[model samples]
Target: MAVSLLCCDWLKEYKTRHRVGIQIRGTVESISKRFFTEVPCVGQVLGDSFAEIKSLGMPEHFCEDELLFILNTDKRKSLTLKYYARKILYFLRQQNILRSLKTFLEQPEEQQSALEGAVLVDQYCNPLADVTLEGISVQLDEMVEKVKKTLRLKNPSHPSLRCAQGFFSSKAMSIPISLSVLYMTLSHKLGLHLEPVNFPNHFLLRWCQRPRGEGNEKSYQLLRDSLDLYLTINPDNVQYLLLQARLYFHLGIWPEKVLDILQHIQALDPSQHGAVGYLVQHTLEHIQHKKHPVTPDEKRRSAPEHVEVQYSVGLIMKHKRSGYNCVIYGWDPKCTMSQEWITTMRVQQLSKGANQPFYNVLVQDGTCRYAAQENLEPHSAPLEIGHPEVGRYFSEFVETHYVANEELEMRYPEDTRETLGKVHELYHGLSLDSGHQDQASNQPNHTTNM
Candidate 1:
């Protein structure tokens, strides 16, 4: 969710006018032209394409591409649309945004997925060109199995169980709409076309069939078939809205479009029953607030870090970005990951005078690798450190921390202090002036580290 310009104040006036039934005529054509009249480039771009598809979400298997366009501090910076668009006041928004705007406009028109069609089909799923609904579904089912294996494989006896329902760890820990959203995303990415239809209970996919007499592939096509999958979602309004937001975020849906859908939802279900109306309103307000160029100074303040952490080798932790549990094996005071990863990370902006710590952990789904301190979080449940070579380093899991036995020191005494220091610094951000504590001592609380 990028910084937006349409806030509650703007919505307050707009909603008031709507409530009073004051219909404003004319398309956004006129509005965009008038609004961006001074900014000719922007006006023209808007007239051509209101918004571009920046990026989209991927299935768990494609987790690495989640934030596909990494926000580089040097390359990618953020400011409210106002500061840049309107050129307001001293905090002159960076020129990078203008560069991005130029780059965005310069991109091939085919990349503007929103303008292409609401009925989005993959490159391979062209009904007229050559694919059939049944054939697509068969292919989709196979991809679904791959998705299933990447996540929960077999169905649980109790259907409503969190794991059975596509939730990992627990209901509270994971996103509410994980299953259907991921399932639908994977199916779509695997060449199945989908769009929600008028019917409340049915989720449908629109497919066009070529006319029998048509000789040309580019001729006007007919809306001949729709692939309907029997999909049912529990009537939970808050979660439902959350899912909608996540899906829209994943699909690169524009805020204005989302606003229209929210308004439509309000009109469709006016009863304001079962939290749906409230959720809709809250989300609408959030969307509007995000669009606002002006933000209160209070919202700009960064909160202090509240977490007190003590980590150890053999201590199981979780990868923050990927949500995968990993076992700590080694640590690096300096950023010493792969050249690609290290370089990719260097563009990131961090707090002044901050140390970029690196942790060497083994991700369960894949291989052992290193991630920055900013990317690893402590895991609660004990993940039996399953790396076969665990015996090569750690002696025992004394607690949350592991200890290196006498055998390690006898073999490589030179490397012992470095290993211990890496663990110590990562766990406790302390000055060397404060005497280094004994590695074997389980006195995390007694020591001032906490």
Candidate 2:
């Protein structure tokens, strides 16, 4: 039977080319200057004007400084600017500016300063989402308890205090943002100050403390030389500075205050690396694509191969007296064939009258073997079942019967035992083969021999 159903639909490209009804030509330099001048600062426009500009597709390369200036025009208290900055940052990530912003954000704070005022607050902030510092902090606390419980369960052998140590060392279970927030919350509750270090696809926390000394003179010296140096140098690192800014923002630090710190760092050093670039690029892209944005093209990627069936064969047994027929299907994707063979045997019995099931069982094995031989060079080693006793019996049976290694043994010790067990379990009235069981029972333990 032919199943004529839709497998997958190929995407059709739709092009909507529009001709410019009116054209104006200008020099590249002049166009660049005009572009900067025409792009309004984030808070300069009212709701209606902002909506119109957004509808027209936000132009690339706007003056971020001017936008900040406008945001701060009314004592740096423009709710409009705050709203847009969040929105822009979100938009930038959607537009694949994540990588760029991550890189820009990672640059030294001084270097980032060049971009501070230039990058509009609206470009990074959005007013639509009702996210609050308190709400996020509460969420962080909840997440921490969850992580701690999960870790305790996952590593019962480890001490409760040490359970979280694995989270730091093991790459397998890297701390996610959700977990980071929890850690941040826990730190606050425990009276330990810690900030999230936003690394790519992972997070780390940092804690700073002042050094102690006995007397005032010694304490002052230690504080100035050791404690002060450590405090001053630690946050100076680009990664640390960006993380501090993020932590401050989450802690309800004023947007302008955050910007001020960001600008100082940017001014000190401008080299772009890691998270900072991701933050910046994400902000810019968001501002430009607030509306009338183009849908990103989807790329078709190949799926990963999971299990491979190595080799397979079929066996048939005919009962002349009862007029019943039984077929045994066997396969080994890897050299270890026992599990697949057992499964196939059960399936064949269950599917005795079903054509599709029988054929599918046979065809799948054949396909797997063919693909393995053709695609894989010089064929990898067949899966070895690794059970020493089973291996010994198999070897002896092949030697005695002069059978090929691939052939299933008719009277192997393990097979005989399994077959006898199944017969006893399934057939209460019938007397089964005793000689095969006796032969298997007489075999010496291979573990002792080893």
Candidate 3:
């Protein structure tokens, strides 16, 4: 109860000073730019993102400035690779959903900006439909207190069932932090005076003094400088570095800093050198699977002559050869079938049968099969694809079209691209200069951080 009051009061005072939380609204770039400038160390988050990628053996030198290229470029595709670069770019980008969050917080109306951030990942974009600002404040305060009581918080990814089910995975829990910087981004945006503390193995968010502006600024810079120094003096902070390295590995992302940290750990304790070093190397190769690429999915394809003819996943169509209604859910660029079928379709063109794309579909009665691209047509009849599971997999089942799930993840069999992965739901197409496109899209466009 006391915490809840404090939460409410703190918010009230913050809103009183700002008059409106206008700062919360903006495109992710705009918000991040402001956030990095205003909040501490957040500017380096783009570079730090590679820190997670680096552990998986991804190069620590992944480009930082190309983020805007993705924001500005048109969607390009490669029929040969069956890959969409824009989708990967979009998968990694985030919009500041803070405008919605700000309104949800009941902050007074101020000038609105772009409305986007990195913290607003693909999932958890929307708040529970009926929740209110004050209601969420009370709940957040309670949860924060609960977390404080246990003080056993762990990094995300391999989170304990309690934290996952209780806080992040549960829509009822009010907020989620897919990344630590996300929580810090939003907390500081809300004037919470929160700071990221490098607690031994994991990270923690703690309150810092706000009244002492100059002192706080000095101390914050000093703290940041010390971290830079420690990371530079690699041997001194091996354990802390190891904790971060392993943390990203568990989260299915790489942590390159792990290399620096690992070298020191192995050198200081050679007994661990062989085992730990080998395992880290194995994980890196596994994550960056160049050895077994199913396709050159990185290739981009502009609107080739028949790009529109290529049915998107979740598109309803009719199998011309079989004369059956079906929905297109996947595509296979090459066929990998057993001898029995190879014997049956001996005359089938190798381009379609052996080494070109075939449409993977769900038939009317609900079984999956691959049909040649030439043997399919856009369903012209006014019949609904009533496969019972259609509703389960698609966003909408309109008579004329199948609305794809907004968070639909693109996966291929070999798990190569799936390792490094692509961008999630392409909420905004290259038409991205207009962020309204995202809000207007069918995806649940709610926003909250930590």
Candidate 4:
């Protein structure tokens, strides 16, 4: 998962509030919004549309048409919504109720799966439309039998079971109540009275009543008797524990807990957990605060040429022999791999041999390589390296190179700045030489028209 860096203080406050029993409302959509608001780097790197889709967990609110609108909005760099319809849309989508209802109207009565009536109720009394509370109530009452029959079904495997159960749980009408609170809060933020309404997933419209207005307001009527199933997660459930570990990693929180869960998963199923093993290794590396385990000591060098690092992290370099483009993420003053690797690659044949700096680079071919500094040159025509682990190290692509994110910066703080500085200096030197040549070409004809 691409990282979403949050404000440390905000995360601390959330943890505190969670401990104190102060509930955090809103659905995953709101959570995703908060995530993007914090980690602007994600949008910068992956493009805004990709980041937006990832945040939703499932693009329930954003169908194919809605996705196109967002994609176009990204390209045009415009489009604003005044209402909290997005939040409601996100929640409905996650509940798997949005599309099911929209498609239901197009299908026969026997084909209607679930939440068809709620979709109708929303269409009729949308907060953006001039519909009455009584009208919404009558619609809800009429759909009660259908909703009850659907909810009462004994199939535990149905995905629709997740929908509106929050309403039928200990707190009835929770969906509407929570949404009302969300509407008020968002309206306050926008300095306007607005609520959520989706025009069958195409348009988002809002309608708000004034304080002294005598007109009937739109409302949601929560249905009853929907069953909610809760599962017990203990230490033995390897799959669930693996998921928990991944969730911790995804949220960018609790490194210790992530490591522990991953370790636990590895322990529970030693033979079949190769992926878990990789995660455990990565977690351990992260915890150790060392990019390379055997970093050579430059200060206590035994020889003059020992541990002399030339290129810094984030530099785009091309291998001289094999001619592959790669980006440096780490380096050791000397080759740090085992003697077996050194022999296999024949490190002794090179000019500097095993004593020269060896960079840890992400190759364009989606593999990592540790190449001797003698083999690398600043790429003549630098382009983006197509590596899977690029996001793990870099945040954004600048004109000529990738910018290191907070994690990479922490690992090698000075490298990012120094690397860019050197590149800029080289560029300026070339530009000055070119300018002088241009000036010479434009000079007055001193040779008397020869």
TM-score to native of every candidate shown: 0.23, 0.16, 0.26, 0.39
The superposed Cα distance between candidate 1 and the true structure at residue 22, in angstroms, equals 92
Candidate 1 regions exceeding 4 Å error are: 1-310, 337-339, 345-355, 398-401, 405-450
Q: Candidate 4 — worst ten consecutive residues by lDDT sum?
A: 222-231
List, in order, the clash count of every candidate structure. Answer: 9, 56, 23, 1
RMSD of each: 25.2, 28.1, 22.3, 20.5
RMSD of 2: 28.1
Off by over 4 Å in 4: 1-307, 447-450
* Cα lDDT listed for each candidate: 0.39, 0.33, 0.42, 0.53
lDDT of 4 by residue, 1-450 (tens): 224454256667555544322111223123333222222121111212233444544323234334333323432111111011233333333234334334555577655533435444454333223444467667766686576667668665555555653234323334554766676788779888765543322223355543311111111111000100000212367655666565444534335757767677777788637877777677676546422334322222234654477788778899999888999977877889999999999999999889888988888766677899999999876778866456556666665777765555655666776787777866656788999999999988678554
- Candidate 3's C-alpha runs over 4 A off are 1-272, 279-310, 317-352, 360-399, 402-450
* Candidate 2 TM-score, C-alpha based: 0.16
> What's model 4's lDDT at 14?
57
* Candidate 3, 1-450: lDDT as tens digits: 888886677766555434211211112223222221111221122323322223334221122123333333432211101111121222233112333333433433333221211122111222212334456657867887676556555533334434533333222343333456688888889977777765333354656642331112234323433343334334356555555456434433323444555676777767776656775896667445523534323211233522333445655577666687887655654455676776686626544555555666666754556677778776655355644334323445444445443223232222222211211222223235457666678677587876
Candidate 2 overall lDDT versus native: 0.33
Q: What tens digits encode model 2's per-residue C-alpha lDDT throughout 238-287?
A: 65556555543443322343454466567667764444555545444434
